[model samples]
Target chain A: MKNVQRIWTQGVALFGLSIIVGIAYNTTRIVSVPWIAQPIQLVNEMDRILKPVYEPSIKNISIDIAKQLVDKNIPFIDARDDEYYHEGHIPHAHSSGDLIKLTEYLDIAVGLFNPFVVYCSDDDCGSSEELAYQLQSEGFMNIYVFKGGWKEWNASGLPIEITSNE
Target chain B: MNKYIQLGIRLIVGGLFIYASIDKIVDPSEFAKQINNYHIIPFGLENAIALILPWLELFTGIGLIMGIYLEGSTIWIFLLLISFIALMGQAILRGYNIECGCGLKEGQMIGLAKIFENVIMLIALYWVIIQPKKYFIIFPKTELEE
Candidate 1:
């Protein structure tokens, strides 16, 4: 019993020390994160763009929203690697794997005014978000990130097309 | 032979923990995102955990290696390994298909292999706990008894 108490005490002390050191070291870092994360607010209006302020233009949307966009024939961008895209992808989705190449394709095939959805492997994959951000920086607007991505879409038995190996 | 074995366990576990902490300490935000991928932590508490966890790993690892607060470090190591196994197991069961956030390897997905690794470490820790004679301890357990 006494040994347990002593171990517990030491554990607490170690935790406290870690907290102190962590906070102090974080303060010294130039790219320190907030102690508490703030919720991401969706920006919908173009009026906010006029203020010369930069907010993330890409908004995360659920599978339902993605489906609605697909119904309306909004363009879909597959952000996975070329091989995965070749294996299978959402119907009529465009992908080149290379961001610059994809951007060029988007410019030639679909104008910037058209709203599009971007997706990767699944909710756990970060490539879709990353691609969306890159697209945003490249002056693309009205972008939506399909967070559920290909895994969810495929599991749901949605329409998908495979590129033929010629 | 027993003393040498104990020392080996300490070095392996301590070195592993310290190595695992470096990447997390360097990129707390990325670590937070990886933790969030598990979808277990609620109310965005992953940030707070991300901030503190690496430091704890570092300190406890140093303590284990140097034989400072040996019992406390071992206990913490046990708890951490259990937590890791549980988290990885749940992620696999739920089909989350996320990165392990282990800090040891980048893009290492959650799967049976990770859980197995943690179980091995847990077994090592058990040996440490049961060993009668602790070797090369800078601060002996007797001091805490007093």
Candidate 2:
């Protein structure tokens, strides 16, 4: 009984301490931070994880559509960072990865009417969706996020381009 | 058997949690989305869990390693393991293939592999909790409160 009581006491104390500290810390970051992705944005993330149908401008496409796009020489944007792109990327995917400069990149890479696919390192990385959203918000239509991303591309042994020498 | 084995277990488990906490601490929004994918917790609480869980994991880990509140930390860690197994198991059953949000590793861990991983961790924690004796404990024994 005493051991149980002691554990309860410590547990309550520790839990309370954590709540107080966490709220105090996170509240400041959530309110003031421009770059920090805030918690409010997470509420609908799962719902949007699958193909988003609500927005006519943006959609999710399968590996095959991405392949067709590649074969047709349609535009493709690599959502991953510069390092990943330089290492190796889809044969001709362009880097428009910087969040701040994405719209500028879209202007340089393709016309507003051109349909293209965005992909990152893998499905788990949200950068592709982030890029697609950025494209949609910037008034471009026909953006498809290749959720399987580069992992699937490389795994399938598709043609790859390496900007850096081995 | 050497009592130091328990200390080693404490350090290993605690170290694991601390390591897991770092990425989640830096990227709670992604972690929260990972939790939301399970569809187990209500939507409103996801943000709260995202904000607090890393700190709880970190403190519980520290408490275990330092033996500051051994009984409490072990109980909490055990409870965590159970919830992890339950959540991952349900996600598998429901067929939502998503990341485990373990925060230590890159890439998505889905399906049976994730459940099996949680089960392994649960077994390890059970061993820590059911030790016959403890050595180098930092907390005062209840009897000493007299």
Candidate 3:
């Protein structure tokens, strides 16, 4: 019994010592500032980790296909929410959301599909990519991602179609 | 079986912990994703956990390797393992598709395989605690002359 107790005491001491040392190491912290130091480090690291392979750029079509009111010829797909779409969209741009539910409007869009263009809020936004990928999976070809998207179009001071679905 | 074998295990496990912590400290956002996916903790605590966990791993690893505090280090490792087992169990229950975060980037989803691995390691750790002669000791060994 005494031997067992002695062993137990030793175990307790070892456990306590380990925690103290462990705590000591963790308490050491150095100020590594962002932008000045870490950002450069991360960019260099990201360059290595992000794959080199490239997917073909999705094409951008610049034409007004609705009743020929505007003199542009391209298929525009809107990748924004219903709220944004009802507020305004590039004329003749189809919503991917309604397409998912209806599935019938897909043919009308496909019928006019030459230089298909997908656009969303802006370049940094991912909705356009998601819609394009979904469309591609559904066998629609000639897809393009409008890097400029809505912000660019509005910023360019081009004509826009606005509605009050609200 | 012997002191050398125990030391070898300690070195390997400890070294891996230190190596794992380095990457996590460098890229915390990714580590935060791993912790969040487990869903054992809420979103509010995720960032704090992401910041603190790597440090815990680092200290535990360094302490074990240094062997200056074998008993403390071994127990900490044991407790860490227990916490890990619980976390993995929770992850598995919640249907998370994440690596076990065992410092391996190729961390596979927590599954029966991982549970088995943890169980085996826990047993080995228990043995180390019970039989201190098998592990590296901070105390200098008295030389025996025949």
Candidate number achieving the greatest lDDT relative to the actual structure: 1
Locate the minimum summed-lDDT window of 10 residues in model 2 chain A: A35-44
lDDT for each candidate structure: 0.80, 0.72, 0.58
Candidate ordering by TM-score (highest first): 1, 2, 3
lDDT of 2 by residue, A1-166 (tens): 8777988988987788778877777777755222223322222232233232434465666677677778877678887768888999998888874555766766666656556678887765655765575567677765777878888999988899988633
Question: For model 2, what is the C-alpha lDDT against the true structure?
Answer: 0.72
lDDT of 2 at B133: 69
lDDT of each residue in A1-166, candidate 1, tens digit only: 9878878988998999999999998999998899886644444443332233234455777776677667767779987767788999998898846668888877776556556778988977656765675687687765777888999999999888999645
The fnat of each candidate, in order, is 0.53, 0.27, 0.05
Clashes of each: 0, 0, 11
Worst-scoring 10-residue span by lDDT in model 3 chain A? A35-44
Best by DockQ: 1
lDDT digits (tens) for residues B48-133 of candidate 3: 56666676677667767776445555676788778888988876664443456666655355777888877777787787667625
**Against the hidden true structure, what lDDT does model 3 obtain?**
0.58
Indicate the TM-score of model 1: 0.76
TM-score of each: 0.76, 0.60, 0.47
By lDDT rank, best first, the candidates go 1, 2, 3
